[model samples]
Target: MILVTGGTGLVGAHLLYRLASEDREIRAIYRTHSSLHKVLEVFTYYTTTEKAEHLFKKIEWLEADIIDIPQLFLVFPKITEVYHCAALVSFSPRDYRKLRKVNIEGTANVVNLCIDFKVKKLCFVSSIATLGKPISDKKMITEQLNWNPETNHSDYAITKYGAEMEVWRASQEGIKTLIVNPGIIIGPGFWNKASGQLFTRIHHGLNYHFPKVTGFVGVNDVIDAMLKLMNSDNFNDRYILVSENSSFKDVMKYTANSLEKPEPKKDLQKWMIATGWIFQKIGSIFGFKRSITKSDINGLFATSYYDNSKIKSAINFNFTPIEDVIEETGHLFLKDNAK
Candidate 1:
């Protein structure tokens, strides 16, 4: 049997849908009862409501948190393959501690159990944020680039990098492992979370677009890459899974066209970003969520690119174009909102 963490998340949900449809004996861990809805919602995105209900019943849903070692251990008896996707994603400074505890420490615990259980293979989901930033000579970040400690980094990036360390350590301890550094994953489900936030914010009429360029991939492609890597003899390897490097302006324009909303016409100026961060800092004093920060502003304006040729070469896979990904996800968002 296979055990999957974060099985209710955007990527995890899609992974489970694929695994279950393939008639694999799968067990998925979740922290809350409400998260189950997201799993079913994702299945419904690909199939009929009745078929989704049937697929949902096929999964062995277990209530467990990655941080809770005792609870996590109970579900590992017969598990052979492990997919570690559970992580806390937060950009706010206030969430720094929680992100570290859950992302870094929790991943360490998962690594410990994988070793203890003698699991056959472990597939880890890491972010492109863990990759090094390009400098003078280097134009694109790849698996070969080493992270520079002197550079400015987000707390989320810091935690994910730490998590990658745990996975690398596990590989050293003789656990066959595969790590995927995915870009911004655009998909349909849980519209308020992660990349789905882009759809929600755009639908609600966001008017400003950042000029930053970054990597992007659809949710299905990420899952497909993970499975392909796990099934193959490729072990102790890391691949950058990105479909394309695109600017936020084009992404927002495509999104606006798909949603039938007014495209964001205003380019965010440096002064406006500075003022916004200033207000966010002031609001943080009153316990307001800090949506934007100095690190975010810098990242938003930087033109970072990723080299995805490694994964494509390894898996012999082609990624879905960003336009189609945006359009499909946009339709799903509209359909969900209409209900």
Candidate 2:
């Protein structure tokens, strides 16, 4: 049986759709109250009634948290392969501990099960953040990049790095493990006020500003790479699963234009990074939602250019441009706006 965690997430949902079509004996784990619930919430938000009903029923879901080792084993008894995707991808400072508990310890727990169950291959869906930052050589990031948590700007980064470490440690124990560090995932789904901010704001015409950030790949492309990894013809070592490094401005403009909306009037200036930090500090002191935190503000300016040639060349895979992902996202949001 194929055991999966975070099955309700965007990547998870997309993976589930693919797995269901193949008639794979799939098992899914979820936190009773998880961000994936909002993934489903977005279905009704963006999809037609017929589409929502059709997609929802096809996914065979099992409710369990990655942290609950006993419960996880119950759903995934004698698993053949495993996919670890559950994580707290939040950047909030206040919830940093919660993020660690789920992203780090929870991942460690899954790795342990791999050892106990003698799973054949374990796939950990790590993030590009674990690589810390782009190197000065301007080459595509490869498996050579040892995960460095020191450069991490957010708790999510640290946790993903730690979880990856767990997988590396488990690999030492005879569990054939592979790590795929996917960049930002953009695809079909609802935002539900959490991720909703990105979809809603951009669709409602608030995405006029862009950050000088980097790293983007499509949900379809990322998933395709994962399936390729499962087939064992790609790189024998860890791979950087990225498409291209583009600025946030390009993504925003492309999105707006694709949705037939007016382009944003302003892209984020370098000065706004500092301004955002100040505003977040003040908001934190006043017990308000700091829309921009120090870590987030720093990350906006931190990303350097990236080259995803290693995995692309190894798998002989050509990536879809960020524009394609952005345009499709725009269309999906516009359709799901619950107009």
Candidate 3:
């Protein structure tokens, strides 16, 4: 039996659809009843309504939180394989404690349960944000790069790196583990959060585009790589699952064109970002919500590249082009909004 955490999330929902289509005996955990709608919506993206409903019924849904050890303990029984995908993604400084609790402590709870249950295999979904900055000699961040604690990291990155440490400890204790650090994952659904918000912001005529470059991959590629790695003999190793390194300007332009929306015209100069961060910081003192942070300024302007050769060589894998990924996701975005 397989157990999946965060099964209602963008990656988990899509993964559940694939696993159900293959007729796998799967159990998934969700925090809320409303989130189940997301899973069905994702299934219908690839199949008929009846088929999607049927596939949705195949999952043994359980309400659990990873941070609650007793609740998480009940989830691990009879689960031979596990997919750890539940995570709190936040960049706000106010969420630092929450991020640490959920991403780091919550992952620790999951790892403990996996050990207690003697699970056969574990797959963890991590982000490239945990990867260290590329050094002067090495232009691309790879699995070989060691994290430097001295370097400033966002609260979200810090917790995820800590989570990776727990997963590494699990491998030492005899659990076969596979960790995948994916770049900005692009997919349809959940427009209010994460990468899905990129489509929303672009469609609503975002006027500024930053020049920072980072790795990107379609959601399907992420799922494909995870499934292949878990089913294979690969374990106790990490893979970077990036398809291409692209600038936000190009990505936004492509998304705009796909959505038939006005392309962002401003270059979003660093000075402008700095000025906005200053005002946002000042506004925070007066109890106003902060939409921008100090770390966000650096992230928006930094040009960091990721190397994918390791995963490609490890699995003989090929990635879908980002342009095609944006085109398809944009089509779906338009279709959903048309309703």
Candidate 4:
């Protein structure tokens, strides 16, 4: 039997659809009943409502939180393989503690459970955020980059790096583990969260595009790589799953064209970001939630590229182009919101 955490998230939802179509006996944990609707919504993107609902029903739904060990323990029994996708993604300084608790402590609990259950293999969904900055003379960040603690990092990144440590420990303790550090994942559904919000913001006529460049991969590619790696002979290794390194300006322009929305004409200059960060910090003092942080400001203007050669060589895989991904996803976004 297979157990999946964060089965209702963007990656997990899409993964569940694929696993269900293959008729795999799967158990998935959910924090809320409402989130399960997200899985069905994601399934409908590739199939009719009836078929989607049928596939959704195949998953054994268990309500559990990765941080709650006792509750988490009950779901691990009889689970031979595990997919650890549950994580808290936040950039706000106020959320530092929460991020550590969920991303770090929560992952620790999952790792411990995987050990106790003697799971055959564990696949962890990690972000490129945990990866260190590219070394000198290297243009692309790769699996070989060693994280430097002295460098400033977001709370989310630090905790995820810590989580990777736990997974590495698991690997040493005899559990075959596969860790995938994916770039910004682009997909349809859950328009209000994560990279999905990029489509939403674009459709709503966002007027400013930043100059930073980063790695991006379609959600399909991420899930494909994960499944292949888990079934392959590879274990105790991490793969970077990025399709292309693109600038935010180009990505926004492509998405705008796909959505038939007005492309942003204004470039968000670094000075503007710096000014906003100042006000955001002050606002936080007055009890306003910070929408921006110093680390975020740095990320906003810094151009970072990721290398996908490792994963490509590992799986003999090909990635769908970002332009194609945006076109299809934009079509779906319009269709879903047409009502």
Give residue 252's lDDT in candidate 1 (0 to 100): 90
Cα lDDT of model 1 by residue, 174-239, tens digit:
899999999999999977777787788779877777788889999999999999999998999899
Instruction: List TM-scores for all candidates, in order.
Output: 0.95, 0.85, 0.95, 0.95
**Which 10 consecutive positions of candidate 3 have the poorest summed lDDT?**
279-288
Clashes of each: 0, 3, 0, 0
Candidate 2 stretches with Cα past 4 Å from truth are 33-59, 132-140, 149-152, 193-196, 233-236, 270-295
lDDT of 1: 0.87
lDDT of 3: 0.88
Could you give candidate 3's per-residue lDDT for residues 1-339 as a string of tens digits? 999999999899999999999999999999999999989999999999999999999999999999888888888889999999889887778888999999999999988888989999999999998887766623989998888999888888899999999999999989999999999999998787777877887787677777778999999999999999999999999999999999988998889998999988887766765666434322222122456566677777788889999989988899999999999999999999999
Query: Model 3 reaches what TM-score against the true structure?
Result: 0.95
User: Pairing residues by index, what is the TM-score of model 2?
Assistant: 0.85
What are the per-residue Cα lDDT tens digits for candidate 4 across 109-161?
Answer: 98898899899999999999888886552377889988999998878889999
How much lDDT does each candidate structure score?
0.87, 0.69, 0.88, 0.87
Candidate 1 deviant stretches above 4 angstroms:
277-288
